[model samples]
Target: MVSRPHGGRLVRRVLPRDRLEDILRDSRGLHQLDVDDTIYRDLENIGYGVYSPLTGFLDSVELESVLLTMRLSNDLPWTIPIVLDIDEEARRSIGIGDTVLLRYGGQPVGLLMVEEVYRYDKRLYAEKVFKTTDPAHPGVARVMSMGDYLVGGSVEYIPMVRDGYEDYFLTPMETRVLFRERGWETVVAFQTRNVPHLGHEYVQKTALTFVDGLFINPVIGRKKRGDFRDEVILEAYKTLINRFYPRGSVVMSIVRYAMRYAGPREAIHHAVMRKNFGATHFIVGRDHAGVGNYYGRYEAQEIFSEFPDLGITPLFFREFFYCRGCGGMSNEKICPHDRDLRIYISGTRIRESLSRGVVPPGEMMRREVAETILSFENPFVE
Candidate 1:
């Protein structure tokens, strides 16, 4: 059976086309606020059930719960805080039960039923969510940049934004339907921000051997400098999937959620999203969602033990490298070859090679994938 969604039900906050048209008839007079592309992505995810059990931005209570307990107000395991922060004075005239139209890119993208507007301590949020107050950390930097107020309420999303890679975008509902139609009762989701390499392939196929299908979900959004561009990751995966995987055994999709780099907490958050997408299992790598040296290598794996009720099974594998002795990718759990014969698969090395117009050796990345990546003039995010 497919795993149940995080809150035991899929949320549908999207307004139907006819209903949206009706609402827009009075849109000009509504109290409106402007947000960024990240909030637009959040609205889409919330409406489409990617963030199941959460119909709106977190209220003060829910935000406190998630920040301290790493769970929602109802005790469901939720890690990252999904919030709508605005300037403090923005809510002065807005009372509870009011409706605020949220605009992005000069268009009304969604509506929020204003339930509560509250203030929070920025450094505390930084310390609790990202575990550090250092401005160098991307997550902390975002926290520092947020407004003084958070508005919480249910959302009525009007899918106005076109996140790139429209051809491959799949909502939670769509993925669930496709999984069932294909009879994939045990699908394993592999999330990635970087282009695939042989190390990735070895881990994915090894997991696929135990599951009915593989969900190749790429996390797409504002990634850090030097990370592969969204299109590069998708195109490279398409090439690898079509050329190597068996037919009808894989589904490629994109999730346009911004990365928080919150280490262990983000791992659980990732699992919950994939679980909502009908994946029975999720792959958690060492330093999952970790940036720099902020977290221990196994922290992400160890955090799973706290949430035994989290529906998706987490598959933890040791770091992999190519062993000359075995002439294949092998992890510490398998290959017994001496270190001298091993060519550890490093994403940095591959990126450096590609940046220099040199294709990484086949031991690290497939020749086809390397070529595809090389074809891009500047594949990394600037």
Candidate 2:
């Protein structure tokens, strides 16, 4: 039995946290796709004050900014779920600032990881490492740190696709198979890339309002050039989770999937994958599967209506806009200033500020999250 932490109400449980921790630690070498904040907001319902610990120190204004960051990328699919085994003859390697592709049967299928590199204290850590960038390349990128030193840079990538590694890649349906086996009735999967922003906090809390348990799953794949490395992103999220979300309400995991800039369709693909991983419901939003306006505003939301046959549920939300009247999260309905209050932001604009070393507006992200995002280079422009 598995239990969830819901607003002072505790459910039944069979496996203890320590037991789960042990299982996770002992379980090594699994093929997976990684994700980030953008994917997280698109997958679940989250709200503020859900994680009380961090909320104590984080102001409501700051929290709203985080929510904006989460909403901005909410529609984009940041992960493609897969399963990897420990004993598999998986080839592994490491690098920085390069996108990886995972393919199957010579057709580009899905993403593995978006690579981002970070330098700190005389060492560079390839923080969030996961599997396959393109479906064509079923390789692995695992990050191992040695006492603050990053390791796993010299391993070779096994030709997963050509070498008959297809068996190792768990399709969405197969992921559902494993989730049912785990007995995790309700799984709340959280996504992110930059750091846990306030809007992100809202999205995760909002999701908990309806789910059984939460997975603060961030992407640790190859990233655009100049993006924050895995180590930095990892530390940022760990700090946010530790200081904020409930200990029992959330489980932190890394999705090894990469980003495909394909917003709406990709968003649908992500929800389906999460369903395969045992998620009963997934979050979707505006511009889902979009790249520079490649997708219509509601394309991602509209796409979900087509997937009822896939046996997955989607939580579609309008873009989380900041309203001056509400002084918090408000949509056009409640927000009288829809015309005046609506502010559209992009990773490009955020990166522009960061490349100049100026922290972006809290309206776009929490101060702390903004600090982290700004500290990194803008891989898109670079």
Candidate 3:
């Protein structure tokens, strides 16, 4: 049995002290949270670049609101002060030791069972210190090389909310165990906070060609106002899988955790979390976890190469395009259609169409998916 701290206003969590210390040292970039230039500079100081999913979800105003949530909200169980992962004010409040129970549409869906905290050692950090003018100065190149060695493994634990214990779905461990027990050699997971589009179908189907199974996991937690309802997405997927995909080839489920929209970083974290749930691989595509052009098109793909220890191979698929020549959905190589022949349904454009009661074409969405979007109230519009 484990003990939990008491206090309605204070969030409580359990974490290893050594790991917490390393995280504090490694995450020094948090301080430069607001300024994009400074934030990137700090990331570079730590041997990384700045590109995240939150780029589109955050602006000056929203960033400040999230910052307040990080500092002032009691709902979060993790204790660390969320540093500037987004615009100056954008942040999340959960420290090292807390348990996060996630829900979707009033149903407990899953939990982020975090444990086994690892941090960067000062010795490793010391080894990387460089003196610009001194020949004896240590080279940071050494430190960057040891980043994975410093903190490479993950912890095992479960999440729960006191009053809603049963509602706290206990599937992370079971899911991992069951997948391993079965003969499924590879499982590739996809994360979504949006409705499925033609492009999504292309990726998931493409992933199925290589992996034994595909998990179409959609985040059903708190999302942007304009985002479609969880039920709509789920029902549409069900219709799609039944009519189009091979039976038992795809497993669609809801991942009801509030999104950080931290783009590339979030993609890494999502892949790691899915690995914890027993996925052997993840499908990452252009603008993954992205809202707008704040992060580059391929930034998420680039970040995966930076962390090789993850062991989860990111199957990077090219963007999908509708080729009039092929008369169906296709990727860059297979599609010979010119710019004028293609039809795209961006999140912004989809929402715009829905606001006016217009269903997007099969090019942007399937007929069933389009109908589903039209039936629902436009959260962004009303």
Q: Pick the candidate with the highest lDDT.
A: 1
Candidate 3 RMSD to the real structure: 14.9
Clash count, one per candidate = 0, 75, 16
lDDT of 1 by residue, 1-382 (tens): 7889888999999988997887789987788889986788888889999899999999999999999999998889999999998986677767789998899988888989999989998898899888899999988998899888899999989887776578888888888889999998899999998899998998999999999999998887877789899899988998999999999999999888878899999999999989999999999988999999888999999999999988889999889898999988899889998999999998889999999999899889999999998899899899
Q: In model 1, which residue pairs have backbone atoms overlapping below 3 Å?
A: none
lDDT, candidate 3, 280-314, per-residue tens = 77889887765434457888789776566554678
TM-score of decoy 1: 0.97
lDDT of 3: 0.50
Each candidate structure's TM-score, on Cα atoms with residue i matched to residue i, is: 0.97, 0.50, 0.57
Two-way lDDT contest, 2 vs 3, winner: 3
Worst 10 residues of 1 by lDDT: 87-96
Q: Model 3: which ten-residue window has the lowest total lDDT?
A: 1-10
The better candidate by lDDT, 1 or 2, is 1
* lDDT of candidate 2 at residue 185, scale 0 to 100: 72
Candidate 1 all-Cα RMSD? 1.3
**What's the CA RMSD of model 2 in angstroms?**
17.6
